[model samples]
Each structure stands twice: as C-alpha cells, then as structure tokens.
Target: MNNGAVIFAANVDRVARFYEVILTMSPVYVEPGLRVIASDRTELVIHGVPPQVLAPAASGAAPEPREDTAIKPFFVVGSLAKARDMAPLLGGFVFPPEREFTSRRFRACNACDPEGNVVQFRELLVSAI
Candidate 1:
C-alpha cells in the first residue's frame, strides 16, 4: 500500500510551490485545488479548502482540528551525500548527520521545508559481502 501525508493550508499554490521550487519536488497531480508533491517513495499533498470550512484534523472525523507540524516527514535516500546535496536547493541547513540507534549504517538529517515543516532524509550503508 502507498503511504503519504496529506495536509491543508491557507495558500495551496504557495505551499505547492514551496515543495516544488525549494525542495525540488514535483507535483504528481495538480487540479481542482489539490496538489500532490511526490518523490520516489514519498508524497505530501496539500489540499486547499475554504476558510469557513477549515480545520486541522490529524486522524479524526472533525472538519479540522488544531494540529501541530512537529511530526516530521521522513524519506529514505540512497546516500547521505546525495541527501546533503539538497540542503542548498532547499535553502535550509542540514542538522548534522546522525546514525540510527539500531542501525549504524543508516544516517539521517533534518531539513527545514519552505512552509516551516521539518523533513528528514536517511541513507543506508550497504553491508559488506
């Protein structure tokens, strides 16, 4: 099954552009006030809704409930070098690379998105034969 995070924002177009120009992400689909930013295995969709019917809802039936953006989105990359290379493109600082607690071969860093969201990219080190 495909997994992704869907969010609602005040400015759908601006939000979409943030991911597109800043993060180097392209929209998988764009129409009807909906934008889906996608990478190889990651997707982040921002749906534009009327202000009157706006509400932040995480996992409930509410139209929208107050939600925090603290929950970061993590995407896996093939290498740390490649992920770090995106720092400039995103116009953000790479929080020093760190190894996973259980997996030393895996390294990750947090990058700030244009819309004030934190995104993480990780790469796994190949095991020796």
Candidate 2:
C-alpha cells in the first residue's frame, strides 16, 4: 500500500515553503489552499485550516480542547545531525538524534513544524549496514 499523510496548517503558503526547504524538493502540485509534496516513496498533502476551526467555541461555556489529531510523518535523511540543525532554519525544530536500542539500523529524532505539528527523521547507520 502507498503511504501518505495529510497535515493541517494555519498558513498554507508558509507551511509549504517551510517543508520545501526541509524536503529539498519543490511541490508537485499546488492550489489556492493545498499543496502536495512528494518524495520517491511517499507524498505529503498540506491543507490550510483556519485557527477558528481548531479553536475552542466562541460561547463562554465551551468544552475543553480535545486531543490533537495531527499525524507525524517520518522522513528519511542522509544525516540526522544535519537535518536537526537545519530544522529551525526551515521553521521547524528537531530534538537531538539518538540511536534506538531495539532498532540499531538508524538514528532517529522528533521534529516539529512551525505550526507545532510533529514529524520524524531518521538516518541509516552505515556501520550497522
């Protein structure tokens, strides 16, 4: 099955630009409020959603916010260190990369976009190959 993900953004254009830098690839498709970015194996669909839609009700008696529904997409990178360093420049944040004990094949880390949606990046461990 093909793997893909949809990300909601407060500003489509800004988010698209941010991802373009991180992915190092231009979008294959772009519209007024949507963009489709693709890698060799997967595609990411970024959709623009207004803050009001995601915010609590205007009524004084609104329920508490619900759990987040954002889906984090895992990306493969050539170097986790470099990717982590570049994240902030591209309007994202990457925590330090660390090797997993269970999966010694790669070093992985978590990152977040400008809108606070998390994504993951991993670099294969050449020594483990």
Candidate 3:
C-alpha cells in the first residue's frame, strides 16, 4: 500500500514557500501554482487555489471555529520537545507537548501564515529510545 498525502490550499505559492523557507525543502517543480516537494520518498504537492474561491479561514471572522473544510497540516519531527521549542521561529504557538500514545510524543500547534492560512503543526517522537 502507498501511504501518500497531498494538501490542497489556497495560494499554493505562498504555502509552498512556507515549507521551502521554514522547513528547508526545495520543490522539484518551480511552477507558478503547482509545486512538488520531496524528502526521501515522501512528497507534498501544493496546487494553486482557483479564482473567486475564498479560503476556509478567510470565510469567517475571528472567535469563530474554523470551517469544516479547514485543513490542519501535521508533520512529524525528530524531537517533539525541540520542535515545540522552535515553534516561535515559525510564528507558531505550541498547544502543549505531551505523550499522546504509548509509543509517541505529540503536540498540536497553530501558525497564522502570511496568506492567512491556519497551519496546524503536530510534532511527534516515535520512540523514546
């Protein structure tokens, strides 16, 4: 089975640049709206948002819950604690780091990207050893 994921967001260039600059990923394609970033075997595709389409986050005002279609992007890091420590570097706020399952450490954090996308980050440590 192939376990693959693709997150489609409004303003693909902005989202793609976030990963490129912050995550240090270089996209295989330098297209205007479509780009693919790969690390080892895992890849992420960022496609441009169509015109006249309002992003989920922009469709509502503050104090209201994010819409149902809002995307919460998750990426596993080498150290949950360390990743949490670096949250501020990406303009992110860590929710609180803790062990989620018997075998992993996890945390939920959110960042308000320049394009107004609510980026949710989940840093997980697979094993303590």
Each candidate's lDDT (Cα)?
0.59, 0.67, 0.53
Number of backbone clashes in candidate 2: 0
- On TM-score, the candidate that comes out on top is 2
Please write out the lDDT profile of model 2 over residues 17-115, one tens digit for every residue.
Answer: 767777665688898879988777777788988778653122323222222654556777787677777766656667654432225677777766666
Q: Per-residue lDDT for 10 in model 2?
A: 66
List candidate 2 stretches off by more than 4 Å. Answer: 54-71, 97-102, 127-129
Write one digit per residue (lDDT tens) for candidate 1, span 7-121: 6765577556655654457888888779998876667798887867653222212122122656777666565565556544543334555533225666676654434456666
| Residue pairs with clashing backbones, model 2 | none
Model 1 alpha-carbon miss at residue 11, Å: 5.3
TM-score of each: 0.58, 0.75, 0.56
lDDT tens digits by residue: candidate 3, 13-119: 65566555544466776677688876664567877776667453332223222335556666655554555555445433344544233234665555444344455
- Which residues of candidate 3, in runs, are more than 4 Å off? 1-3, 55-67, 70-73, 79-103, 107-120, 126-129
Cα deviation in Å at residue 76, candidate 2? 0.8
Candidate 2 vs. true structure, TM-score? 0.75
Task: Indicate which candidate wins on lDDT.
Answer: 2
